[model samples]
Target: MNDWRSHFGFHTTPFTRELAVAQRFPLPMFDEVLTALSRAVDQRGSAALVAPAGTGKTALLRALVDQLPEARYRVHYVKVTDLSKRDLCREIAVACGAQPAGSFPMLVRRLQEHFLSTLADDGVRPVLVLDDSHGLRPEVLGIFQILTNFEMDSRLVLSVLFVGQPPLRDLLRQPAHEAVTRRLVHLATLRLLSRPESHRYLAHRCTIAGATTIPFDPGAQEAVYEIACGNLRATDQLAAKALEVAHDAGAAIVDSAHLATSRRLLWP
Candidate 1:
């Protein structure tokens, strides 16, 4: 099998999810959100990022983490899973480099002390990033208020950033979760790319992969935008399959016909 990278004159596969920080495309949609999150972090406040699936929510989180200065922020990223409150605290304890073996109540106190000591001893703000928080159980999410409370929530010792899909926003809006919602300094949302932006997005991916010229033709790009509706993950899947179809056909450039085949193979 001909390697797609070499076949397409790319140093690496384009449209991959695991893009290096330096190689990540600048997403303008996230600029305001980045600023808001950074401000929240500086103020030791909390923020929520809501977006539809495949719209680069995780990517935006990574970008935000990358932009934050290490000297000022100790960022700990956690991908929330369906777990009991005790298990969740264990996960957080591990992330913060604290002992994870303990009773539920003891674990909470230990994590709290770790956060306080991280600030008092290291003099760097600790920012906890929870990705896919929409999956968190209501009871588990509620624990955040208790975890963040220091001196009755008057002194903010830890900044928390929650990144999730729209369901997360709905979860936060419920009266039951008011304790967590009230602490939110900002709520940012991400949208799919526009038509023109989709074109540039593809080109940017290609350029970063070491392509001097875009291998996807204009019509093919339009087909991708139409099929994926500008969602980054969908676009990436369609574009990657389209490239494979084009390469298999010994085509120099991906065209509408390749995209059509990709849509059929990928969706059907």
Candidate 2:
């Protein structure tokens, strides 16, 4: 069967969630968040990144990891769920290259010492980036405060970053978690793209995929922004589906009709 790539003369599928760091869309809002998070990491401080679903939170975390140089930073990226505190610490210990086979208390001490030695002996930064942290329980979140406390909290040996959806903010706001919240040096929230930015984003994706000209009609572009509400992931899904629908129908450009059909076919 003929695919959209052949129909559109694309080098690869456009509007995919797969982000090639070299070719990522240069969004100014993302840059601003990156700057704040980067500064927090540099200072060996913790920060919170909160955004709604489909707003490119995972992509932003990957970009942040890529931008931090390996020579100076030892970064461990962990995607957390509702695991128990012991299980979570074991995962963290494994990520830090420490033995995860000890008792729960031993595991915690091992990770704390690992972070300390990583900075004091190796002279490199240890950054713990936790993604999807909204599911972490209140008590589990408190473990970070204890782990980050080294040398009587007089010195910082590690940097921690929490990336999750909006519920994470509410989670942190709870009275019990206020201690964890106070440790955050920055709180960055990602917003949806503006209408003009969304238009440019579509063009940018098309250009990166080797399209000499945009295949999405102006009306289709407007439909995408409207239906997807400028969420990056939603835009990708809708745009890719529209392309397939247009190609199947032998349409030269994806129009409002194609977008409407694609949305119905995808959602309903």
Predicted model with the maximum lDDT? 2
Give the TM-score of each candidate.
Answer: 0.96, 0.97
Candidate 1 residue-wise lDDT, 208-254, digit = tens? 98889899988998998999998999999999999889989999999
lDDT of candidate model 1 versus the reference: 0.89
What lDDT does the true structure give each of the candidates?
0.89, 0.90
TM-score of 2: 0.97
RMSD of each: 1.4, 1.2
Clashing pairs in 2: none
Clashes of each: 0, 0
What TM-score does structure 1 among the candidates reach? 0.96
RMSD to the native, candidate 2? 1.2
